[model samples]
Target: MKHITILVPDGQTSLSSVACIVGSYEMFTRANGYWSQTEAGKKNGTKELYKIELAGVSKKAEFDNGLLTVTTHVHISNISKTNLIIIPSLVRDYETAVKGNKLLIEWIEQQYKAGAEIASMCTGTFMLASAGLLDGKNCSTHWSAADTFRTLFPNVNLLADQLITDEHGIYTNGGAYSFLNLLLYLVEKYYDRQTAIFCSKIFQIEMDRQSQSAFTIFTGQKSHGDEMVKEAQAYIENNLQEKISVEQLSSIFSVGRRNFDRRFIKATGNTPVEYSQRVKIESAKKAFETSRKTINEVMYEVGYNDVKAFREVFRKITGMSPLEYRNRYNKEAVV
Candidate 1:
């Protein structure tokens, strides 16, 4: 079993705990969202004020240079059995500690020297760069911080194009949502294709390989103002396996069919029908890669009742027949 320890500074992005780690994951949060066990606790109301757990790990809370410090002594008084150390995100002032925090810097150096995989998500790359672990190593961070990171760590090979970069056991990802891609990438690497696909489906995300650049997220135009349109889009994503028509979406949103069509097109740059087809096609691609289902079976699974229409849509969107794409990915998987 692989163990992962996530180090969170005073201010860090709060993500779903389930999304962060798979098994036996430990988090060190400084100041963040309140934790709850049941979904009702998170939804309606609860009395939890976000308590921190100090058991199973030694907790060290101190003030250093005007910053609240919370460090966890992981695997202390033992064999130091940590396979992976993750730095999620850090405070904005973390960059100022590049020269300071010699103890933290040395700890990072020692971890890397002892062969623990070091990884960061978002601006956490600053910590790695500050510790000089990324010197001459290829890494990536949130595209927003590329300029500052480049200026600060000139010696580090920075790649802003990709979602994640893995070099010499050091992995870094673009900020926020890019963590999904990073986790999927890691899942594909350490596990099998089926496991990666399963995890992606569970998360309601399309499975994407790391070679695909992270810039895709920025390129998509957002349409969040209209509540009806947003609800329709969410419905489409959740029901990718079911047949969806513009009329059905309009009815669900309690709008006229003509008005819904116009609004959907205006908001998403694609008509409701077109967008739903794209979603189904993307789902089909995942099914093809992850399961032993035949191309026809995948077609039906993605809501294409007619085989001919499914093939045409798949080719139109993917630039290849379903079988062709499947064969290509299969060959690559074998290699």
Candidate 2:
């Protein structure tokens, strides 16, 4: 049987972490049980496909200052091996979360080195990334935590736009609550597409949501400790309707053009140009949400005169055309 281990982390974890573990366990165990009860499942031997359990640093995981405790099936130091390790979204104070679970982190590394696949949910990617498992690998985390994640793990190809990423034996999902997508993906991979669909209906998770871009709210990084880059972000936000230029920003901030671009990227995980585009697109998003203006009008309001350029940029950032975005989100849109 394929063993699935859900790593229960300590610190101020979200209830979704428990929810994630239960959901995964339920789906896998239910699938096996359901199929076993059926003649086809019995004949095919699909019922004994997976075994699920929770593993942690200790037998009892205390959270919220001992208010809640999750008893584990196995302790990390005791378990020799498992087929898969699922890292649930730990607490948001990622640094403390990592520090508190040093042994669990080490155990995860050992498991990965022992030929087990590692999957991280939301902020759990922080732990995997902390263990250097995600270095040079494409991964994702919750869009809200994108800035912090990028700042901490620069080597990780943090694809914040994707809902899920699978590289080598590691899997990552974009957000904690949206983890159902990744779960379904895993279910489909281990079982079958048909089983995944059936499970989705049972769990009420939407299938085939490939991008987190549409739901993402673009908030520029301002906590990178660069005052000049902060000023540049403020300028871009303030002057979206104006023709904002890199040279202008660099000169305004008393930095050289190439050097300014580099600094801005380092400070915000986005080049000056990319940052400006994000600012403009975010402004356009607000317009679509609050105004009855046409797409072209909204584009122009955001200082883009060329229709094609505006549409392309809008689609790139939002994962939908201007019209589609407006139709979906704008309450004022006409029939």
Candidate 3:
């Protein structure tokens, strides 16, 4: 049986951390039980395929202002070898998390070097990246953390739109409940497709969810201390109904086009044009969510006249066409 060690890190963690730790342990345990009942499992003469345990740096970890606590089954030092390591989500500031959980991070690195696959849930990618395991690997995390993750770990490829990322035996998933999909993925890999499907049915989790883009709210990056770029971002947001151009913005700001583009990208992590489209799309999304606006109406309101062009850009940014996005979000929309 493969041994799975779910790490309960010391220090502050989110409620999702609690869910991930408990949910992963239960899922794997149930998966083992379900597999045992199968005809194939009978032929193997085994009752379980995995030995699951919760390990932590401390005996207990608290959450939600100490209202809840998880008592780990074992300590990290006690486990010399593990087949897989599961790191749960942590509170937002990863630098603080890394500093506080130095021992756990070191242990994670050691385990990986010793041939264990690692899976980080949600913001747990922060810890994994802090350990340098994701330095050159592709990973996914909460979309809201994309800018911060990019700034901190530039070497790591952050696929913010993806629901799950699996490379070099290191797995990660996007925010919140999306971790369920990752569990399904690992079930299919470690067990079989049939078993994974069975679990998905029981858990009521949608299978093969590939993108989290539709759920992302694009808030422009404004922390980069560039006054000119900040003004440009403000202008784009305020004037979403107008067709604005990068050259126009540059001329208005009195900066050369090339230099303006560079500053905009450096400050906002997007070129002027990309930022403009994102801003407009974000406005269109709000209109779709709260208003009973037609797709064409919303498109025109966002400064796009051509229906085809508007649909393409909306789908590119949100992974859903304008009508589909409206129907998904607006309860009044006719599906």
Cα TM-score per model? 0.47, 0.92, 0.96
Local distance difference test, each candidate? 0.62, 0.85, 0.90
Cα lDDT of model 3 by residue, 1-335, tens digit: 67999889877587889999998998888788898888877888988888899999889888888989999999999999999898898889778887989998999999999999999999999999999999889999999998898888889989998999999989999999888999999988887888889999989999999999999999988768899999999999899889988889999999999999999998878888889999999999999999988988988888999999999999999998998888888998764
The TM-score of predicted model 3 comes to: 0.96
The numbered model that scores best in lDDT is 3
Off by more than 4 A, model 1 = 10-79, 97-102, 209-335
Listed per model in order, the count of residue pairs whose N, CA or C atoms clash below 3 Å is 0, 0, 0
Error of 2 at 156 (Å): 1.7
lDDT at residue 301 of model 2 (Cα atoms): 82
Off by over 4 Å in 3: none
Quality of model 1 by C-alpha lDDT: 0.62
Per-model RMSD to reference: 17.4, 2.1, 1.4
Report the lDDT tens digits of candidate 2 across residue range 95-114.
88889888889989989999
- Backbone clash tally for model 3? 0
What residue pairs clash in candidate 1, if any at all? none
> Candidate 3's C-alpha lDDT?
0.90
lDDT tens digits by residue: candidate 1, 167-202: 899889876566777766765564445555656666
